[model samples]
Structure formats: structure tokens, C-alpha cells
Target: MDARGWDERYGQTELVWSSGPNATVAEQVSGLKPGTALDLGAGEGRNALWLAEQGWTVTAVDFSRVAMEKALAAADRRGIALEAVVADVTTYEPDRSYDLVLLAYLQLTWDQLGPVLRTAAAAVAPGGTFLLVSHDLTNLAEGVGGPQDPAVLQTPEQVAGALGGLRVETAERISRPVEKDGETRHAIDTLVRAAAP
Candidate 1:
């Protein structure tokens, strides 16, 4: 969806996503030492806020103004600070490097995804990490929740290829149980963590 479409959706509801961070984000980052972080497509700023709470200086970027506002308010309510930037990830350029760059479920077409992934990788400082978690392409047939469009779905291999210069720490498809309509089902996800050498 375009930025305006996302903004309209966020306007329709008080919260589009859960107030908590994504499960993969919490699991992967909890053990790491806090540092500068950039959260691309930071929908409601849940992950960004959580990183800030963990003592990381976070920059939350999203294309939707509505989402950015909500994210900022969430930070304020939590008595934490976060930098909010409203811009398309495909075009937005980072001014400096970060210790950690997060791209949580920022699904896009192959044409768009490549550029954003490259940009995100370029923003990672030496020895820093560039982590991505997204709905796997197989999720269409095996998973319960997530966008149904195949154009936006990606695989771990595809993401790894996009991040050319980074050393891949983890690149695999994993399953997670998702609760929907009082039923539990497994959702396939692509998790990639690449470190800049």
C-alpha cells in the first residue's frame, strides 16, 4: 500500500498493531547490548519504544504521518524518547550509521525491496547488525495471518541476496504460532540478521 493508504488505515483505528514489539524482535534483540537503532517502517513504534527502554537511541521511520504521530504519542506516554521520521524507506537516506538497523515486516515488491534493503545495509556501521523479519513467501499456503499478496512476500534467500556486503548471521525460515479467532495456527516467517564486516 502507498503512504496515503497506510495513513488512512491508521486513521480508521486507534491502533493498527499491538502495542508490544514483534516476537522475533524481542527474542533477537533482548540479549544484545543497547546501541543506536533505526526502525524502518516503524508502524506504531512498539519496537522503537522497546529499544529506547532498553537504553538504545532509536530513530523510528515510517511513511505514514498518522502512524508517526501515534508512535510519538506512545513514546511520550511511556516516558521515553524516540526520533520519528516520516518518509518512504525506498527514498529516505540515513544521515549516519547505526549500531543496529531493523526492518520488521516492511514488505514491498522486489523492485522496491532491493533498494530499501541496500539502503538499510549501508546504514549499518561496522560490526553492527541489520535484522529483518518478514512474512515468508510460503506463508501464503501455510500461514494464517499477514498480507496475502505474493508480490510483497519474500524469502530468506531473497533478503540475503539483497544484503550483498553484509555477513549473514542468520537466514532461515521459521514457524511461529499465531492466535487468530480463538484458534492457534502456525505462520511461516523469514528471519535474516546480517552483520557489517
Candidate 2:
């Protein structure tokens, strides 16, 4: 979606997504030392805010002005310092590298996704990590809730292959439970974690 579309959607909703960090992201980051972090496509700054509370310096980037404002307001209410930026994910260039570069649910076709993923991976500092969690391509046929379009969903191999220089620590499909019609069904996701040398 474009920035305007996202801004409009964010303007209409109080919280379009969960207020907390992604479960898998929290689990994976639990053992890592706190450091500078980047959250691209950070809609409401859930991951960024949680990371800040964990003592990491975090920068949240999203294309929507409304989303950025909401994230800032939440940051203020929580007495947490966050650097939020309004920029396009496909074209954004970080000013410096970070210890943790996170991309959560930033869906795009491979043509648009490849360069951005590579750029984000390149922004990882030495011994740092680049983590991604997105709706798997298989989520459509065999999974519950997520985008129905096949163009936006990604596969584990596609994501792992995009990380040029990092050593891939984990590249596999994982299961997530989703509530639908008062029933909990599962959704597949591609989780990719790579570390810089």
C-alpha cells in the first residue's frame, strides 16, 4: 500500500495491529544484548517501543505520517525515547548501521523486496542481526489469516537468498496461531535471522 492509503487507514483505526512486540521477535531477541536497533515498516512502533523498554536505542521508520505520530504519542505516554522517521521503505537509507535491523510484515513483490532486504541486511553492524518475519507464501492455501494475494507473501528461501553477506542462522517456516470466528487457526510465516560477520 502507498503512504496515503496507510495514513488513511491508520487515521481511522486506534490500533490496527497489536500493541506489543511480535511474539517470535521477542523470543528471538530475548538472549541478545541491547544495542542500536532499526524497525522498518514499523506501523505503530510496537517492536521499536518494546526494544526501547529493553534498553536498546531504537529508530522506527514508516511511510505513514499518521502512524509515525501515533508511535510518537505512545512513546511520550510511556516516557520512552524513540527516533521515528517518515520515509519510504523501498528507498530509505539508514544514516548508520545498527546492531539489530528488523523488518516485520513488509510485503512486496520480489522485484521491490530484494533490494530493500539487501539494503537492510547491509545496514547490520558487525556481529549484529537482521531479522525478518513475514506471512509465508503457503499461508494462502494451508493457513488462516493473512493477505490473500500471492504477490506480497514471501517464502523462506526467497528471504534467505536476499541476505547477501550475512550467515543465515535460521531460515524456515514457523506456525502462528490466529483467532478467526472465535476459533484459533494457524498461519504460516517465514522467519529469517542472519548475522553479520
Candidate 3:
């Protein structure tokens, strides 16, 4: 989906994603020293707000104005001032580098995803970290939940390969409980945390 499509979807929904940060992201980066952070495709600012509360200066980027407004509101409620911008993550560029760059559950085709993520990863400041979490391609058979389109799902090796010059901190397949039709299923996810090299 493109920016307009995401905008429409976000406008029609009160909250499309969970109000909390992704579990893997939280666990992976929780021990890192807090600093400036960038949340790419930040929906409703959940991860951004959480990072801000944890003492990181956060910038939340999304394509939907509605999502930014909601994120700002959430940040205000928490007494944390989070910077939010409504822009296409594929093209948006940061003014300054950040200590942490986070991409959580960004479902995009390989062709469309690669360049954009490469751009975002480049914005990580030296000594900073880049984190990515997405539904694993193996999830189609070994796990459950997430977009059915295989184009968006990637293997851990694929993710590692896509990133250049980053020290691989953690690359593993993780699981999450997915709720569907009043039942819970396991979702296999690929998690990667790399430091800018």
C-alpha cells in the first residue's frame, strides 16, 4: 500500500495498531542507553511515546495526519513531547541523525521496501542502532497472523542481507500470540537489531 491508501485506512479507524510498542522491539532495545530515536512508519506513536518516556528524544514519522494527531495526543497525555511528522516514509528524510532507528512491522514488497529501509538505515548516527521487526516468511507455514501477501514477508537472512555496514546485534525468529476469531495463534516474526558500522 502507498501513502494515500494508508492515510485513508488510518482516517477510517480509531486505532489500527496496538497502543504499545512491539514486544520484540521493547525487549531488544530496553537495555540500550536512551538517546535520540526515530520511529519510521510510527502509527499512533505508541513506540515513539514509549521511547520518549524512557528518556529518548523521539521523532515519530507516518504518512497519515490522523495518526500523527492521535500520536501527539497520546504523547501529551503522558507528559512527553514527541515530535511527529506526516510524510511518506519511503521518501522522508531526517534533518539530523538519530541514536536509534526503529522499523516495526513495515509490510512492504521487496522492491518497494529495500530502498526505503536502506535510506532510513543510513540516517542512523554513528554508534547508534537500527532495529527492524517484521512477520517472517516462514510464518506462512510455521506460524500465523500478518499479511497473507508473501511479497511483504521476509526471512531473517533476507533482512540482514538488505542492511549494509551495520553490526548484527540480534537476528532471530521470535513468536507472538495472534488473536483471530476468538482464538489465539502463534506468529513467527523476524527480529533484527544492528548497530551502524
Q: Which candidate number would show the highest TM-score if scored against the true structure?
A: 2
lDDT of 1 by residue, 105-164 (tens): 998999999999999999999989999999999999988789999999999999999997
lDDT, candidate 2, 76-185, per-residue tens:
99999999999998999999999999999998888989999999999999999999999999999999888999999999999999899999999999999988999999
Misplaced by over 4 Å in model 3 are 181-183
Ranking by lDDT: 2, 1, 3
Clashing pairs in 3: none
Scored by CA lDDT, what does every candidate get?
Answer: 0.94, 0.95, 0.87
lDDT of 3: 0.87
> In terms of TM-score, how similar is model 1 to the real structure?
0.98
Candidate 3, position 4, lDDT: 68
Error of 2 at 182 (Å): 1.1
Every model's TM-score: 0.98, 0.99, 0.93
lDDT of 1: 0.94
